[model samples]
Target chain A: MQFNKAMILSIGNELLIGKVLNTNAHWLSGELTKMGFIVDSIVIVKDDVSEIASAFLSAIERKVQLVISTGGLGPTFDDKTVEGLARAFSLPLVLNAEALALVREKYSSRGLPLTPERIKMAYLPLGSKPLDNPAGTAPGVYLKYRGVHFFVLPGPPREVEAVFKTSVQPIIEREFQRIDFYEALLTIKGIPESEFAPFVKDAAERYKSVYVKSHPKGVELGSPVLEIHLITFGIENMSQLRSCFEYILMSAKKLGGEIIVLKEPGVKL
Target chain B: MQFNKAMILSIGNELLIGKVLNTNAHWLSGELTKMGFIVDSIVIVKDDVSEIASAFLSAIERKVQLVISTGGLGPTFDDKTVEGLARAFSLPLVLNAEALALVREKYSSRGLPLTPERIKMAYLPLGSKPLDNPAGTAPGVYLKYRGVHFFVLPGPPREVEAVFKTSVQPIIEREFQRIDFYEALLTIKGIPESEFAPFVKDAAERYKSVYVKSHPKGVELGSPVLEIHLITFGIENMSQLRSCFEYILMSAKKLGGEIIVLKEPGVKL
Candidate 1:
């Protein structure tokens, strides 16, 4: 039951309109990459019910074992992800007793009246396991259907992070075997890509699994900058990978280009 | 011909690994939205040639009238976006004289040696138009085939922004009719979403064209915040849209809630 591939669905129009920054996707991607999971793709759709349903179908078609959706879980007109999910899977929407109890307690703790609208948060797709959200009122929903795991988390970054760390990560770890992974980054500045190609080519030819990428940084002051990155990953032991990365760095230094920054694991920037 | 839809393809693995932030996509989305163009989606893929080609085909299949890809125009093993674009369109890669001249001048201006690898920046898809990149060596590529317009931009934020403003924006504007749109945001705190549902329903019912969306924000201490946004478009005039938005804001205020913040055009925060 190991989940090798995942798809992220971020539901929000604010992101499309640039009203809010999308830090949730970046944080989730980084966390999953560190855990040795391959994120296939990320899709950002509006809060429309049809769009959510269509995105879900597409993720399933892509064969992503785990589909994580963030947003559209609140008690508002546009918060329809739960309804969409249920409709997509042909499951019924019912009020869960545990979720209702959590909602009531959450409102009571704040000395606020448990209004009819607040009760809406208790509704969940049939057969979903509710994960407690201590940071927010909206509890995360986890559903498994036809061998695919779908997680619905609240939109807020803090709430999403808290729920993922406490509930989702544990399940993922338990289900998937541990794999060794390592990554290295070398940031070069003020070097043309052509002048740096020979060194990069030599490194790539030496290491079969290593990948070198050049990002053309726009001109600064009067000179252009190109950030050359060397990335390597494998499922076996990481010592050889670390050694290969070190050798690449040493070669890059010998090439005599302006190296602005270098960052790696167990090393501070 | 009016280009109403566009898809952005960001080429880099640094984005996936969290080594670099993707500010280009955000900036491009905002700029396109302001110009009355709907950005259907954004896909960030690795610099792998096959992946880039597959993504290009997918974007075309999605029926987006315009496709803009950023990155992979440099002279390295990973800089394969241009080649991928050529292969995707079944066109041969040819060195454009204007593009070569631009590269030479850029290197000579900076007192840098122009190596053979640097000439790779001049190679582009056949029959493509070269757009000037004053800030970098990689000139933007513009190609129109089978009614799809493709614009290839350098990855650097500064160069991309400069080239887009100076060269691409005018061409796009000339080819499309601008539409009028407006959005309003109201940040309310100290109230759960359930308590605010009825108010949103009433407002939506009153304004047929106004779309109401609620984003649950978990940033502020003590009480969770919900950002209620009202977006309206397809109006004949901008002033009418502004007046309509003002009335909606007034209605939201009458519902009796804690309004944390409100922002409007020509008004400072």
Candidate 2:
């Protein structure tokens, strides 16, 4: 029953307080979409343990195939994402020897002592494996609980990117089978979205499998255009993608509009 | 008791599909936080009506003072945010005279006829007032359901910014009392986050109001710095903020760390 749907949770008070922009969620969602996973929702919450648990549980209850959380994997007291995940699934927080070894090595090589705050990261939820984080000290966490795979990565975007590339990407490629995911952007200029809305709606109805979106570009008066984006999932639905594309292209031609940008249907991540 | 809290919901498939980056949520969250509102959560959902309604209602049930949504206030069929708002509050969709007049004026001024889809933007939730959007055609929507104020602005960042600046900001200032919000970033080089995590945590507990975060900056093998961000909401707690600042300053001095960047606390939006 796994539908290749993913949900993203970003845990940090700095994010909530808007001290940090959530580039991680945007990057992850884009990456996952490229990987053919339908990202259901992206949520940003503070570093509260209960709030984290509730957000996680809601995703779990919705039966998403994967949930990716960034931030709150550091050594500070506010970094309670692991504890939150543990509380969400009722798993005991256990100190893993391997994570501790990595932590010790990282600090020792840096000529620093192993402090309690640093050691706190070594304790993960029971039965979850740690993803090696080459970019930083905190190793990312990975756990598969009842068909849903959860990966908790560090807050730093660089660390999250490195860990996702080295560890999570490989595992995702090996484990999850990706479907045909193609998206095309047909940028039409010199047409108000209202004039082309009917055509877009007709295309959406005709091509039931493809998603049709008309994004209004250029907010200024006198010369705004609509960027009609078309997307379809599943390898067997390439025809649907083409049909929607041609329909929009033809519609643009009839309306005397120019196709400014035509992004082909590959991974645009 | 209405607390100064807000939740942001981004309504668009472009956001969910990662076709467009979510700059709106970040900008609005930062502005709201700077205005002394505690932004609780930021949620991004697709253009589906039920999904939008559910997310909006959850924010309402949480009793947040405000819920702001960006996107889907357009002429396209996928633009379903207004309908979603109507469904969420069990209100009938009513066409407002002023909104239709504005839409007509915008279309006629450009030497274009107002299409049915273009007129659709005039339909708003019952009892909701349309905020004038000088930057674009679709007027922003404002509604007060039960106790929460819901503001739905157009998806384009420029329109959202302009509408907020011209319409929403004044209403917020007039209705919601202001509180002092300050945040400072004290960047220290040559100090591992592990070494300073304790101080940040201690400051958070000591200050009670100020949220202290230690963000590890620079991912290289050497010469990394930790950016300690401290934020306080109330102006009466400046002394507490100063106490936390001095403690961190002294801690960095003990660790032989150099202050790389010190951004003073005066709303760093």
TM-score of chain B of each: 0.86, 0.96
Interface RMSD of 1: 2.9
Error of 2 at A215 (Å): 1.3
lDDT (10s digit) by residue, model 1, range B29-104: 7887777667777777777788788778877787988788888877776788988888887899998998888888
Listed in order, each prediction's TM-score against the native is 0.88, 0.97
Candidate 1 C-alpha RMSD relative to the actual structure: 3.5
Off by over 4 Å in 1: A1-3, A87-90, A111-116, A188-190, A216-228, A234-237, A258-261, A264-269, B1-3, B108-116, B218-224, B234-247, B265-269
DockQ of each: 0.47, 0.68
TM-score of chain B of 1: 0.86
lDDT of 2 by residue, A1-269 (tens): 23599999998877776567888988898899888899999999998999999998998777799999999998889889999999999999999999999888888886778889988999999999999999899999999998889999998888999999999999899889976578888788877788888999999999998888888886535676778788887767788888788889999999998787578765454
- How accurate locally, in lDDT, is each candidate? 0.74, 0.86
Clash count list over all predictions: 1, 0
Ten contiguous residues with the weakest lDDT in model 1 chain B? B260-269
Tell me how far the alpha carbon of residue A253 in candidate 2 is from the true structure, in angstroms, after superposition.
0.9
Quality of model 2 by C-alpha lDDT: 0.86
- TM-score between model 1 and native: 0.88
